[model samples]
Structures are given as structure tokens and as C-alpha cells.
Target: MSQALAHNIIAEADYLATEERASVRHELVGGEMHAMAGASERHNRIAGNIFFHLRAATRSKTCRAFMADMKLRLGQGALFYYPDAMLVCDPTDDHPHYKQAPCFIAEVLSPATAKIDVREKWSSYQTLPGLRYYLLVDAERLWAKCYSTNATGQWFEQELSAEDRLEIDCGDAHITLTLNDIYEDTGLLL
Candidate 1:
């Protein structure tokens, strides 16, 4: 959708509400609140695969893995967003309201939302304090790009392909997996 159209459809006067009745997550951009869309088959598969692996690896620890259903309150303007998969090592995130601390966040791109995922959402997620790595899993390509926060407060990116393995450090937890493990059974785009 065009920026002009988005601005027109979402008016500037709709930001007065403090809360909503239902559980629908609304993303606010440029004073417009855009309702999040549902996930596709490929999105579900990628999320499930990632979550399964992470859960198994971190099963014995206090760290936990959450799927798309859980809500992540990234910021105040952005009330909620459902990530494809997330890993939180902080024990405080176990609260009922929403996960406040996320060590790792992943979003599986789709045709309709690829631009938002890669651009707008990426920028917003990078600003989170508890976030260490933000991963964008490509829908068309058999690759993923991870943005890690360096000590200098700058983001360092690493691209992982079919030939590479992913090793992520989440504070108290460490998890490693190969591309083959994530794309098992399901045919990957590579």
C-alpha cells in the first residue's frame, strides 16, 4: 500500500485510546494503526521448526521459547506484535501481561509483509534494550540475516545460508543448529 493511502486510511485522530477490548495487536506507524495480518503455511512451518529446535535445546534451563501466539510489547506506540518465534532468557518475562524481555526475535517474511518486516519492523525491534539479535528469515530465499548488537551500540549483520550453522547466545543460554535441522522434512527455498 502507498504511504499516502496508509495515512488516509489511518487517521491521526485515532491515537487517543488507552486500550482495546479484543486481543488484536495493532501496529502504530505515522499516527496510523495497522492491524497485523495472519500467518501463512510457510510462515507457520518456519516458526514451528525454529521453536521446536530451540525448545529442545533449552528444555533443561530456565530460558524458554515462545511461538507466534504470545504477544510481545515492543514499545508504547506499538502496543503488541506476534513474532514468528522468540527466545527470552530473563525470568521476569514469565509474567502474564506480555513478554517484556526478549533475547532473540525472528520474523518469517511473507509476500505481502516483506517490506514492513525488513524495514519498519526491523528498525523498531533494533531499538529494544533487551533484544540481542533480530533475525529475518527470507520467504523466497533459503537464507536468513541476523542483526546482532555490538558493544559500540551499532548493529552487526551476519547472513546464514544453507551451508552455514547458526549459533546464538542468549545471556544464560546457548543454542546451535544447522540449516538442515531447521528445514528438515520441509523443502527449503535453497
Candidate 2:
């Protein structure tokens, strides 16, 4: 979801410290804090569905799935974002508060954050060398867009509806997700 900038700019360490104790989550962009807003019911369901499938697929594997609370640090700690769902496989990429390497990231798009998710977040996420797949799901409908990198490092975009399935390559394994799975229990028609 889109965020509103908080007060004055603060140091990266200060922001992290504040986040540790603050009840509300915030994203730091270039040392400025942006308070994140709460998500809607449909958005929560979609994100939960993504996390559920990802967690199930990665169970007993080296990779681990994380949901909204985990922070994704980018631009060398100059930026921090909370992705809806993400999969991280690199053991060395771990940090207590944030993760640097995520092979797959999914965001449930709301009207308030669709532009940022498609433009700003997509641009930033593509810069990560470890990132291979980015999925944007529409909260109001059974529609999703996926961008996956091929063996040659070329990114390809695919649009999926209710009948289509999303295939993700996780290096050690490949997982397939259907719109029926993503939109499950959300009351969205396929």
C-alpha cells in the first residue's frame, strides 16, 4: 500500500530502532520515513493466500517464505519496504530486521498503491540481482501480472486471469500457483 511521509528525515539506524518499537510499520526511503497504512479485507486475503501457498511450497526446503512483517532492505539500507509476500533462499542474505535477497516477491495491489507497486516498487525490485520473479495481484478481481527473469536474465511479463497459473522457478524447485489459489476465500469470481 502507498504511504505518507512522516515528519523530518532521520538516520537509517534511528529509523530501524524506531521501527523495532513502534506499533505502526513504516518504510524508509532515502532516510525519510513513510508511515504505511492498513490494508483492506480483500487485500489481506490476497496477501495471505500468496503467503500460504509460498510457505507450503517452501516447507522442508532451503528457501523460506515471509509475509508482511518482514522488511526488504534495498539500495544499501537507504530504502526499506514491507512486501506482501516474499521468498528468500540465500542463507547469507539474512539480517535480523531485514532481508537483502529475495528470489520472489508478491504484492496485492490496492487502488491507493497500484501505481507505486507497478512503477516505483517494480523499478527498485528489478535492481536486486537475486530477485527473479515479481507478482502483482489485483485485490478487486481475479487478475494478476507476473514478471519473471529467464536464464539469460531477461525479464518477461505475463498476465493471468482466473484460468491461468503462475509458475515460479526457485532454483532448487518450481512452484505453480493458480488464480483459484490466489483468490481463494476472497469471494472474487474466477
Candidate 3:
């Protein structure tokens, strides 16, 4: 079972309203709101590495990369989540509070959210038509899991070791994230 913060049931509207004023972030699951915990230094470093490389890669393009602040509306608003990192190439996905379409999503695995990120989110994110790559980044290791969608819209899992490179091809937008880039600044990268 996945652990949730606060462990309370809240309506979607109520959660949204409170989340704006709340200091910390929260994710809505099945109409229930769970407060998001602060990440470790290593986790933030890993996420920041990916975000920095992605931001630079898409700087001149129409796409934008966000680091854990943008909300993703999943299951047609049935679930609201904050992915660790995301890239949206479509202008329509530029919503104020939440985003509907994302070309790529990254989740840095932690003990508390790994199961939910890998299992629940895995199933939920596939529903988006624009999503092409979903990356599961390991904080304690150098490996990552890349799940890519095919032309038929079927998702396949690919393992990325330290020797592998990440090639993200979105609609007219592309970015290549290497393991060293994703783990930059960490001793592992050197």
C-alpha cells in the first residue's frame, strides 16, 4: 500500500482551494488529498539535474519544463498529482493551476512514493494522448526506467543503466538526457 500525507478525504474543489493557500504541496488521489513531503537533498539534486538539462534543451522551443510545481490532472480530474518533473510541448497544456497534457513526466523514486509512482501513476499517466515518455529515476542508484509509448499507443518499459542515454522525442520537440546529466553534481556522475 502507498503512504499518504495527512490521510484525509477531501473534495476536489476543497483540496484545490486549500492547496493554493497551503505552504506545502499536496496531491489528490481518488478525491482524497495527501500532503506531499519534502524531498531529501539527494532527491532534489537528482530532480534539479534533470530539470536543468531539460530546461536548457527546450529553451528556444515552445515547450517548457517544470520541476514539481505544476499539477497534472489525471483520469479526467479524478486524480491530481504533482510529478517531480514534466515537459509540455503543446500550448493548450499551459493551464494556470493544473496541466492536462504533458509530453514527458519524471518521478524520482523514494521510499514513500515509489510504489504509487510506479504502479498507480504508471496506469494513470498512460491515459494522456500526448504523453510519450515516463521516466522513473532512482535516487540511490545510477539506473532509471524509461517507459515510452509506441505509435499504436502501447507503453513499453526500457531499462537505462549508467551506460545508456535518454532520447526524448516529442511532437516537434526533442531533448536528450543522459544518466550523467540526470545525476550531475552527484558523486556518482563523476
TM-score of each: 0.79, 0.93, 0.91
Instruction: Give lDDT tens digits, candidate 1, residues 5-113.
Output: 3344433224324224436655556555667777777677887888887788778888889987676765663445678888989987775645768888888888988
The backbone clash count of each candidate, in order, is 0, 0, 0
TM-score of 1: 0.79
TM-score winner: 2
lDDT of 2 by residue, 87-183 (tens): 9999887688899999999999999889989999999999999899999999987789999998789999999876777888785656789888888
Model 3: per-residue Cα lDDT over 1-190, one tens digit each: 9986775667777878998899999888887778899998889999998888778888788888888988998876779999999998898776799988899999999888899999999889988988999999888777789999889988889898767778998766678887888888877674
lDDT of 1 at 111: 90
- After superposition on all C-alphas, the RMSD of every candidate to the true structure, in Å, is 4.5, 4.2, 3.8
Cα shift from native, residue 26, model 3 (Å): 0.8
Better of 1 and 2 by lDDT: 2
Give the Å error, residue 26, model 1. 4.7
Residue 134 error for model 2, in Å? 0.3
Scored by lDDT, model 3 comes in at: 0.87
Q: How should the candidates be ordered by TM-score, best one leading?
A: 2, 3, 1
